[model samples]
Target: MRRYLLQDTAQGIFFVTISNLTKEDSGKYWCAVSTKLSIGNLFDEVSLTVVDDKTLATMFISAC
Candidate 1:
């Protein structure tokens, strides 16, 4: 149940929020920006990782 939050950059740079992340949620996220000066666009991509809750807890307790 992954979700995306696209903010309105109508006023400039802003923040984006994601929710309900899962293992498959891992991927490249791009944020494109366009302005009057630039005929093209600017993109910022990030790699995300989402691990299973059960697996995470198991690893956490074992490491401790």
Candidate 2:
């Protein structure tokens, strides 16, 4: 598996894309955005989850 860095946007949003996702890729990821504020740096946290192929299939089935 390879870790890919998402491009930073001017809108203060960051994302990461994984290619050729696998079963082992299923996990939680932490994403944060930082910017300088009046007092100090401000941080916003976003959580990411990569689903294994099997789990994704299950999700699709359940959704239907």
lDDT of each: 0.50, 0.43
The digit string of per-residue lDDT tens for model 2 on 18-63 reads: 5655677665544443446575554333333555542321110111
TM-scores of the models, in the order given: 0.57, 0.47
| lDDT of prediction 1 | 0.50
TM match of model 2 to true structure: 0.47
lDDT of 1 by residue, 1-64 (tens): 4365545544564655666566776666655666566456665665666776222210101110
Stretches > 4 Å off in candidate 1: 8-11, 53-64
Off by over 4 Å in 2: 1-3, 38-64
Evaluated against the true structure, the overall lDDT of model 2 is 0.43
